[model samples]
Target: MQTVDKALKLLEFFRTDQPEIGLSDLARLAGYDKAATRRFLVALMGHAFIEQNPASRKYRLGAAFLHFAQVREATLPLATVVTPLLDALSAETGETAHASHYSAGALIAIGIRESSRANRVHLDPSEILPLHATASGLAFLAFGPAAPLEAAVDQGLRAYTAHTITDAAALRGAVAEVRRAGYAISNQGFEDEVVGIAMPFFDSSGTATGAIAVATPASRMSDELRVLILANLHKAALAATAGIGGIPAEAFVRAHGERRAA
Candidate 1:
C-alpha cells in the first residue's frame, strides 16, 4: 500500500501543462530513492499509464487515462440529458450554450451547443477557466465553500481585459449578487468582447453538482437582449436542475412523494 501511494505521488507531478517529468524530479516529488522510483515508473510504463519520451527518456502520461476517461464519460447519466438540452437551447436562443462541472477546484467545460446565429459566441471543448474569471466558475465558487473562494481570490484575479474585475471588494459584491440571485453573469468581465450568464444546479444535499450557461457577443448581450436571454436562461436552468440525477435520498423522496400507492 505504501509503495502504491508513492507511485501515485510520482504520477501527480505530470499535470495539464507539465505532462512530462524526468526520473530525478519524479524521485524527489515522490520522496522515494532513485532506484525504487525507476522500478515503479518502469512498471507503470509497462501498464501504459505513463510513456517515456523517445529522445529524452522523460515520462509522460500515456493513452490509458484517455481510454478510461472515454469510458467514464460514456457512463455519466448527465451526458444523455445535457446534450439534448444544449441543442435545443442553442436552436431556440440562437446563442452558444454549455454545461460544465467544477472538479479539482477548476471549471471544466464538458458539453457545448453552437450558436445558430451568424453573430454568436463559442468556447472550445475541454476549456478550463479560473474560478474568478468565468461565469460558470464564479457561480460554483459563490455557491461552494468559502475557503476555496478566498484562495482563488488570493491567487490573483489577473485582469484578462481592460474591463475585467480585479478589485477584491467589487468581486465580492458580484459574488454576493450571485448568491442572492442563484446565478452569475458576466458582461465583458472575463473576455471584454463577450457576455455570459451561468447558474448552479444543486444536488439533493444542496451542493452544486454542475452549472449551465450561455454566451452571446457583447453587442447581442445588451439590455434588451439580456432580458430575453434571462427568460430563456431561467427556463433552461430549471429544466436542467430537475433532470440532474444525483439527488439526495431525502430530497428524492420528497419530490416523488413519501408514500407510493400499491
Candidate 2:
C-alpha cells in the first residue's frame, strides 16, 4: 500500500502547468531520495503510467490515464450531465460557472463555462481547490462528508488571501453558516478579486458529491447580481443533482424552498 501511495504521489506532480519534469525535480517535488524516485519512476514507466521524452530527458504522464478516464466516463458520464448546467448558470449570471467533484479528499474542477463578457473569471480545470478557501469547498464541508473537513483541519488551512478562513474554529463556523443557508458565498477568499457562490449537490445517499459554483469579479458583484446568481445557481444545482441521479439532503431542499419563497 505504501509503495502504491508513493507511486501515485509521484505521478501527481505532473499537472497542466508542469507536465514534464526532470528526475531531480521529481525527487525534489516528491521529497523522495533520487534513488527511490528513480525506482518508482522506472516501475511507473514499466506500467506505462509515466514516460520519458528522449529529447528533453524529462518525464511526462503516459497514455494509461486516457484509457482509465475513458472507462470511468463511459460508466459515469458526469461531465456530459454537468456541462449544460454550468453553461446555463454562466449564461444566466454572466459569470464563470464551474462544477467540482469531491472524491477521496480532493475537490477537482470537472467542468467550466466562461461568460461571454470580457471581464469574467477564468478557472483551471486541473486545479485542486482548497476546502477552506473556496465557496465550493465550504459548501461541501457543510453538506458533504465530515471526513474531508477533519482531514483539512488536520493538514492545517493555508490562507490563499486575507479573506480566507485559516482557523479551524472559524472554518467550522463558516461551514455552519453555509449549512444554514444551503449554499456558500466566498468574498475573495480564494483569489484577490473574485467572489464565488456555490451550491452543493448530493448523491443517492443524500451526501454531497460535488458542487456547482459561479465566480464573478468582485467589482461586478452587485446586490442584484448576487440575488440573480443565487437564484440561477439553485436551479442549476437541482437539475444537476437530478440529472446525476442524486438526491439532495432534506435540509438543503428545505432551505432551497425557503430561499425561493423569499
Best by lDDT: 2
- Backbone clash total for model 2 is 0
Name model 1 segments beyond 4 Å from true.
1-47, 50-61, 74-76, 246-262
What TM value does model 1 have? 0.71
lDDT of 2 by residue, 92-189 (tens): 88899999999768899889999899998988777899999999999999999889999999999998999999999999999998998999999999
The root-mean-square deviation over C-alpha atoms between each candidate and the true structure, in angstroms, is 7.3, 1.1
lDDT of 1 by residue, 1-262 (tens): 9877777667757765677889998888778889999999888888888899999999998889888877876785566677887888777777899988777667777689988777778686746766777788777776666776788778888888786778888888888777766568887777878988886666656666667888888877667766566566656656766777543223323422322221
- Alpha-carbon error at 30 in model 1, in Å? 16
RMSD (Cα, Å) of model 1: 7.3
Give the distance in Å from residue 48's predicted Cα in candidate 2 to where it truly belongs: 1.9
Runs in model 2 with CA error above 4 Å? none
What lDDT would each prediction earn against the true structure?
Answer: 0.74, 0.92
